[model samples]
Target: MPGALTGIRVIDLTQMLAGPYCTMMLADHGAEVIKIEPVEGDPTRRFGPFPEDDTERHFGGYFQGTNRNKLSLTVDLKKPEGRDILIRLARDADVLVENFRAGVMDRLGVGYETLASENPRLVYAAIRGFGDPRTGESPYVDRPAFDVVAQAMGGAMGITGPDAATPMKVGPGIGDIFPATLAAFGILAAHRYAMVTGQGQFLDVAMYDGIVSLCERAVYQYSYTGRPPVPEGNQHPILCPFGMFPALDGRVTIACPRDSFWTELVTVMGRPELASDPRFRTNADRLQNSAQTVEIVESWTRQLTKAQIGQALGVRVPYGEVNTAADIFADPHLKAREMLVEVEHPGSARPVTIASTPIRMTATPGGVVQRAPLAGEHNDRILAGCGFSASNIAQLRESGVIS
Candidate 1:
């Protein structure tokens, strides 16, 4: 079956995590993502978690995980011939995505303005730390940034950790991933506009802006309360009995924000009288005495295993145990949802498993059906499709324009 985006062609000129993740999601949904790489390949190809026996080091887990369901084409943009090839590809591309620093693409003469002139319907998108000055100017536009920088500057780290004194970065790269996810949506929106009007526009997503959006609750809380929200360990800022608690084996989380669910929990804990206690009767009262409420819950939970806690409260309220990777792999729910999927790894006898796309459709489900390609694996085929003769391709290769 054809994918929803089967007819779309994307020129993926991105590296590392942020840009590649966005393009990968598009590719997974059946876009023809042509990943244009530098001569040495993406820097992430050297990043590891490699299989012990695969000594050639063709690629690592980081590269494979993000670059799947795409075709690879190597070109050194410093060369005129290489720049020409990309311009030719852009002439017919539906979208072009890149995550270089502010002025890099313009320096290469393949920026949005240049491409949009050639292909009026191209959705040219750029992902940057502070965004391009063409769309909106910022004093920190030229400053280099990474996931940690975005997290810290955007207020996520401010309310993330055990307390205000200890600001912790999130384990996953939500800093980069969130911006990329937003960029994907922007690209699709721009594509729709281009399809309808035959006009293209420059779209930019700032990493700092993306992180700030994810920390939206803090914005509202500060607005409503005349004070900044502080970190409160595992608990919700206002909702009581809505955080992690200790079990005999491991930690579990329970959330009963409403009085009805709280009453149900008290009944389940064999302490029905406590639900009617004035100190914990209403949510506001419980919030004011949150520590006492947590203590009361822990006094009962500490004696039971995670399994026992689940047996008591699993289906009643929002409840779950703190699960590790192994626990997730062993979970029947994850298996039933098909969250983890196996794909063939290069130079490995056994297939490797990676997380699948969360998006599902009734008519055209999208997912990772192909493995990541080798560097420049589709060079000849792609160039030929772009009208390059065999001799022209060989000459470009000889002159170091492409790998």
Candidate 2:
């Protein structure tokens, strides 16, 4: 079956996580994503968990995890002939994604304006730390940013840890991945508009701004209370008993933000009489005395295993254990949902299992149908399709323009 984006073509000039993640989504849904790497390849090819016996470092888990379902083409963008090849590809591409620092593409003479002239319906999307000047300017535009920088400046770190005195970065690279998700949607929206109106536009996603959008609750909460919200450990600032609590062997999260659920939870705790108690009668009262409420819950939970508590509580309230990676790997629910998939390892006899795309469609489900391409693996095929003769390709390779 054809994917939803089967007809779309993406010129991927991105490295590392953020940009590649966006293109990965597009490719998973059947877009022809041609990853244009530098002659040295994406830096992540060196980020490893390399096979123990492998002498040649073909690639690593970091690159393979995200770059799956795409074609690879190597070009020396510093060389005129190589840069010209990208321009030719852009002439027919539906989207071009790049994550270089500000003005790098323009300096190379392949900025959005240059490509939009070639294919007016092109969606030239750029992902940057601060965004492109064509959209808005930032004093920090020239400065580079990474996931940690985005998390710190974007308000996520301000309210994510044990307390106000300590802030923690999120485990996942959400600073990059979130912006990539937003960029994928933006690209699709722009592609739709171009198909209808025959006009292309420059779109940009700033990682800092993306994380700010992700932390929108903090923005409104600060405005409403005139006080910066502080981290409350594993507890929710507004909802009582809606965070992690210790079990006999581990921890579980039980949420009962409403009176009915709270009443049910207290009943399951074998303390039905406390339902109307003044300190725990309503959500607001419980929030005011959250510490006491946690004690009341933990006093019962600490005696029981997480499984025992879950089985007793049943489905009357939102409840879950604090699952580790191994727990997830063994979870029946994940298996039923087909969340884990096996892919062929690049240079190993043993296959590797990785997370599949979360999206599901009855007729056109999207997933990691292909493994990540070896560096410059599709050079001849991609270039020949772009009208390069065999001799031309050989000469380009000989001259160190293409690899």
Candidate 3:
């Protein structure tokens, strides 16, 4: 069956994590994503974790993970001929995504105005550190930024660590990925609008804005209390017995924010009477004595292994083990859900496994259907489809317009 985005074509002009990640989501859902690379290729092609015996080194895991299911067409936009080629491609594209700084695309002569002129119904999406001036002006518009910068400036790292004084960046690149995910949603919304109105508009997502939205709880907490919220370590600030607790082998998470669930948990712990103890009777009482409540819960949990704890409380209340990659690889739930998939590595004899898309549809499912392409792998096919004849391609190649 055809996927939901089977007929859409995307021109991917992103190099790093954010833009490529957004385009990856589209490609996984069956969009014909054409990744436009410069002569040197995306810098991520050099990022490592290559197979032990593989030596050709065409690409690495970082590039493979996000660039899957897309075609590569190298074009050096510095050349007028190269820029014209992109203009031609964009004329027929449904969406064009890029993550360059504010004025980079305009300097290349293929900015939103240039492309929109060629394709009125194109959804042009830009993911940047701050945002584009076209929508709104920012003081830091010209400043370059990465994930950490966005996290720090956007308030995510402000209340993210063990304490108020020690802020920590998140393990994953949420600063980039969150904005990329929003950009993808925005692109779809704009595309839908174009389909209805026969017009398209430029949309931009700031990494800073994305993280701010993600940390929305802090916003309201500060507003409600007239005081900034501080980090409460692993536990929630307002809930008691709602965080990671020690186990015999590993840690487990248990949340009991309601009287009924607290009663059930205490019963399972062989301490049912404590549920009604004056200090632990209600959620408010427990919050007032959170430390004591946590100690009481840990005293029982520390005696059991993660599996033992699960056996006792898995379906009764909210619970989970702190899963690592090894645990995830061996998890029955992961297999049952088909969350991991194997794909061919270009330079290796053995195939490799990567996480599959979690988007599931009954009639038109989406997934990783193709491996990452080699640099300029689809140059001939793509240019031919763009009406470039054999001689035209050869002449362009001779002029160093493409690789």
TM value for model 3: 0.98
Error of 3 at 135 (Å): 1.3
lDDT tens digits, residue span 299-319, model 2: 998999999999999998889
TM-score, candidate 1, is 0.98
Give the count of colliding residue pairs in each prediction. 0, 0, 0
Candidate of highest lDDT: 3
lDDT of 1 by residue, 222-310 (tens): 99998998777899878998999999999999997898888989999999998899999988989999999999889989999999999
Off by over 4 Å in 3: none
Poorest stretch of ten by lDDT in candidate 1: 49-58
What TM-score would every model get versus the actual structure? 0.98, 0.98, 0.98
Can you give the lDDT of residue 110 in candidate 1?
Answer: 83
